[model samples]
Target: MKFYSPLKNTICGVLTAGLLAVPLSFSAVPSPAAEADASSLIGAAIGGIAAHAQLNAVLRKYNDTDEGRQEYFQEMKKQLGVNEDYALNHQLDRIMTNLTAGIGAVDPSIYKKPYHYFINNDKSFNAFCTLGHNLSVNTGLYQTLTNEDEIAVVLAHELGHGQKDHPAKGARRSLNMQILGAATGTQAGAVMAAVINNRNITKPMEREADALAFDYITHTDYNPGATAAVWQRVLDLSKSQPSSFQQFLSDHPADSDRRDTYVRRLTQYSGGHVTNSDGIVKVNTKVFTTPAAVGGMSSKERSYFVMGNLAAAYHNGQNKQEVTVDGNTVRMGNQPIMTCVSGDEPADTLAQRLRQIK
Candidate 1:
């Protein structure tokens, strides 16, 4: 199967696994009963057969191009023990697929679409962007992720690589290394170090992906600052234990700029109007005179958001207590809040005025 399609997908590669491309098997097919409790809370695949075909075709196309045909592509998968079977938790697959669509909806169409995703059984926290657009995350990564938002951040980062064409570029470098190795009679490791294996390229590619991910999150419901936390978690998890894996951490240096980048990007988008450390604004309707007076004891704030109208009315109090939605009807608490009003303030204004009281 092949796709002459336009879509980008990326997964973080495990450098250690690149030494060999062995196949992986998590288990014989898990029984339906065993999966009952762990099933994807996000319903079944959205596009059904068509979606499955698109995803599978993209995966197959990874082998069609010159770079894809290179032995490194196959060896890399093998070294990582690529498994297209039940090696992953089915529930996780469903969750990622759902989130993929949600994030894609917000990203530039040039870099966003329903890309196929898979999970490797490896118990280490890593992901990979395959030769073309295939995305894979390790089981350890899925389990290690604290929440769905972090997972989205990771996926967005990988997609950022895809959007930037880093995978194919990395492959080209690897291929060049092999040719140079043949010509100069140098070791593969020595040849790789000159380019693809060089930290110079890898780190920048990662930082680029990080920036793209930051942009994506701000456009979506996920916290824009999620990039830092997730990247930090990946770093911490990489250095945690089983010291053998630590070598991979050293292979590609983490970006210190990301710490500041996260804060800077959110401020750029939200104009520093955002109030919460979580990167989301919470609106309180308990009718407190001032945020300081409440002393942060307000509950029932679950329904309020900085981008919602109630948030605007609660904060600005235009004597009208009104808000406007640009598209479609606005609903709150399952009740019709209001219609899109040209005269009312945009939701983002509230997002700007929104600040964390705590």
Candidate 2:
């Protein structure tokens, strides 16, 4: 008998190991345990084969174009990193189940497809909806929020994006390369993954989402003001950390104008409502503090301070008033200190205004 080579024997052993590791794939019909066991291994093998076959089909479609080939392969590599695809899918399914129930309470047709969530371990405060019914939220964001209202704001924002079909628009853009036959199998995978992984909230889109979120929460017990508060917190959070804003700013560029937009929308939705007596409003101005600074005073605090100063001015009834600061006397305006900080003015003039106020 001819002597067998060790390399060949090793190859055979490796192949056997792979065969054992294969998982079964099944159709609509359920399988018996014995059949299931065999099917699992065969299924895994078949799945891999099927994946490759699909990849090849995409590659062939894009083979004539270099750009297409590049895009295709990139998309392929992204989908292959499934450590626990099944578990993730199941968890996502459950989240959708709950979301569906929640949304159904408001509008049963709010979402056409079950919304999916992806927990990215990134420190950035970002969340986005993607093609094929996926929504990704950064772990950093989830940790930052104190209540369900904040979470609801973020989720509803993404849902708004989904409802508006932003993801589908992105998908169409990616497939534009396919028209040129420039995408490869690998590039296609990359494009798909990118299409999946990208969680950007554009400014207009962000505004739209904010509006939708306001609508979403107002119908429920959740405070609509939390929507504005979340953005305000994001703004303050960005100033000190800078990094936290990276993802948020990327998706939804935070212009002062955008902040104003949110404030305006919230105000309109609430019919210019100021008080949160219902306990539904969960405003955490502390959440808006910069990391370097101590927790900044809340909007409410600033408002109260102004109101108190005005009241004191009225009580004194002076045209110009002087109040004791750290040591020196600070001057108030003839009109209840029209501005917060006093500008240059003669001590006599300031005193004159204080006397007039009363």
Candidate 3:
């Protein structure tokens, strides 16, 4: 079923009538002052009830069945236009396939209501999974993230929301809170819009999704380190262009916090060899390379990512293999650790250092 906003005039009229009746219902009380207080309480109670009913009605349309979900998906796609690019769609499809397989390996019940997803034409670096496991990716995400693992990290985060039904839970929680506030413009339509657009997800829920994304990535062939790298990349980008990332940062946890969370998690695989001191990546209580800014990455931001790669190498047992140098690139087994840039040490020297340290 489709949901539409109630007309402003109709809502205003009902609210006005309710307010007008408040005093009359309490008029029989002996004290005028007591009547006035009672009226105020009754008016607030009535407003809350009205808003709650309207919001619940909107939430009820979010059905879990396949047919009901397809109906909702069609309605949403009409507003969020579909991307016509076959290549982009194919890329998203391949990523989703890999991610779903990973999720299935972790928990198979999520497949009971198979996901429906598509790439939207919206040119924003954001994606959301709404009710019924219906997901959408903005085309602008590709503009920012070219790496498959980075993109997979994003899609996996949304899948975590779907797995836990965060969208609907967050929506209900938001609507109820707004209803209790019942301030001007705290209408059901406004709350529902924010909920569907994914603005209402709480910080705690964001953290949960981040952790789940890391878990899902570890289950797949994708580098689990990308979870930290993606946030570090965002933190680096925001340093240069703060306004571009303000909206996302405001809604989610601090990028530094997210980067650190994943980085700390990644250290679990290193058997205590890898550690992060402040924002710097360290090895065995010794100072490793202090990465300089490369491209958009700041010195500290890049360090976390380098730490992530080192952690992933350990996790994959690549650390057990020979450390090789191919021109500017340093590799542990098949895993590339770092490519010596203009400001960094020579590749062969770095490889020898890795042999000593790792």
Candidate 1 per-residue lDDT over residues 65-133, each given as its tens digit? 445434334444455554565634455565455545555666546443334555655776666564455
| lDDT (tens digit, per residue) of candidate 3 on 1-358 | 0111222233234434443343322122232342346555565567666655554544455547676578768766776788879888888889888988889998897779788998877676888787778888888888778778889999999899889888778767765665564433244445445444445577888889998898888888787767877887787677777777776577788888888788778888666678877656677776667776777556765666677678778877899999999888889899888777878778888788788888
What TM-score goes with each of the models? Answer: 0.50, 0.46, 0.76
For candidate 3, the TM-score is 0.76
Clashes of 2: 53
Q: What is the lDDT of residue 305 in candidate 2?
A: 25
Error of 3 at 333 (Å): 4.0
Clashes of 3: 0
How does residue 238 of candidate 3 score in lDDT?
A: 71
| Order of the predicted models by TM-score, top scorer first | 3, 1, 2
Model 1 lDDT on a 0 to 1 scale: 0.44
Judge candidate 2 against the unseen true structure and give its global Cα lDDT, from 0 to 1.
0.44
Candidate 1 is scored at a TM of 0.50
Better of 2 and 3 by TM-score: 3
Candidate 2 lDDT tens digits, 304-354 = 222223333333443234532222233344333323233334444433443
Per-model C-alpha lDDT, please?
0.44, 0.44, 0.72
Per-model C-alpha RMSD: 17.8, 18.5, 6.1
